[model samples]
Target: MGKLAQLSGPVGLLLTAALTGTVGFLPQPAAAQSLLQQEGTLAPMQDTYSFEGEADQTLTITLTSSEFDPVLSLLDPDGEEIARNDDYASVLDSTIIITLPETGSYTVVATSFSGEGGSYAVEVHPTTEYEQVFDRAVQLFNSEDYTDSVEAFTAAIALDDSQPSVYLGRANAYLGAAYLALGENFAGPQSLEPEVRDAIATDYEQAAALLKEQGKPDLAASLEEQAQIFRLVEPEPAPLRPAEPPEEPANSQS
Candidate 1:
């Protein structure tokens, strides 16, 4: 199993979905299609819209109103608040980018920031291109193309750095590359360049930090231990050469 597959179940789903390139384009029943381009007036109060969303799917929800400052809130299937934003896009408008954690009913509340409602438009769309890149990264890593895997993981990170699993994948790719540089047994510390060593250490450290921030301290600890195994070992200094005898004043001696 690849390093990504070793992550917690929730995180494992993310990779599984990505590996299948099924984020934005997952097949769904006609009745469960995502909500799109809905507009109405909020009659001086909150207006809520409920819709079905798929797991590991990225959704872009945009709210625009001219009369009042718009506020948007997202709720999961259990009514747990996912995120809320006000004026994230422009004046009197709110935009939310959400990565759904599961496939179920979700609620979106659109209201005025000051509770003074007015005409508002809501648009929901999918953003899944990055997931494809993430999938490619996994494939490269599994294929043992460590250098290319690093690049692919980097591309995925550039698209979405919020995913802690991607950081773990990148860290492992860096470690793999470091081992490749050190030869078959990865024991040639003297031959390992400082930059290569630092790259490995830095990636693993980043992964650990991200994992900790994402509430996976145990996983972070495990990664930190792995990182220590590849810690840079400075090359021994060369023995000092014997000092050459001072040249006699040839002209004076002659």
Candidate 2:
């Protein structure tokens, strides 16, 4: 399977629909508008729409349906999968927040995860600065570029400090960086600098507080526990190198 098929939940269905000439295309909409809304039926097939997008433009695309579980994917002008979402949060709906890398006509794909037919609504809108930064940070995190991810998440926090998820993201980035610094197999947290270690704990604490304020006590408690454990963990000792073999003893006989 191609990368698009792997990342996009139902691209196989999309391909089948395409091969059978069953795929449907929605009306092309102007991308300059602040908001674009489309209502369509999946009918056990995928629906595609095209709109112009600009470089560095951040957009939040949401797919919602009461009839079936929705999956959404965005493709660049080159038909590369830019972003795909099977679910947002813990719900069946889907949302993709992405920053366009270049200007071109982008395609939006809407389909059902389970091959069930249903009416769905797709919305495209430019995201706020904070969301764009947060989305980039998340992309960085997923790519394992923890250092840049940390910076991006920090920028996001500066823009909107009230979001628990931002704090959580930064904490994860910090932890990832710590692991990278100490070597992936280094156990515990001993080798980590005090400042970096403390930063990780602090971000988790902050996230927990924010989640508590949001009335999500269970999630808040989990973060709190993680912070406590992280603070107490110790790094494992580095492996000892094997001693060099004794130098040849015998030249003396001569």
Which candidate ranks first by lDDT, i.e. highest? 2
Q: Which stretches of candidate 1 lie over 4 Å from their true place?
A: 1-127, 188-191, 232-254
Candidate 1 local lDDT, 1-254, one digit each (tens) = 00101111111111111111111111111112235556688867787777778899877666676667778888899999988877431124566677899999888888887778677666555645565566577668768898898899899879777665566667667767777766665665435677766666666677678667767676667667656655753445799999999988757553
CA-lDDT, candidates in order:
0.62, 0.69
lDDT tens per residue, model 2, 195-238: 87788789878977876776767667777777776687544579
Candidate 2 residue 189 C-alpha distance from true site, Å: 3.9
Total backbone collisions, model 2: 2
* Cα displacement (Å) at residue 46, model 1: 44
Q: Which ten residues in a row have the lowest lDDT in candidate 1?
A: 1-10
User: Which residue pairs collide in model 1, if any?
Assistant: none
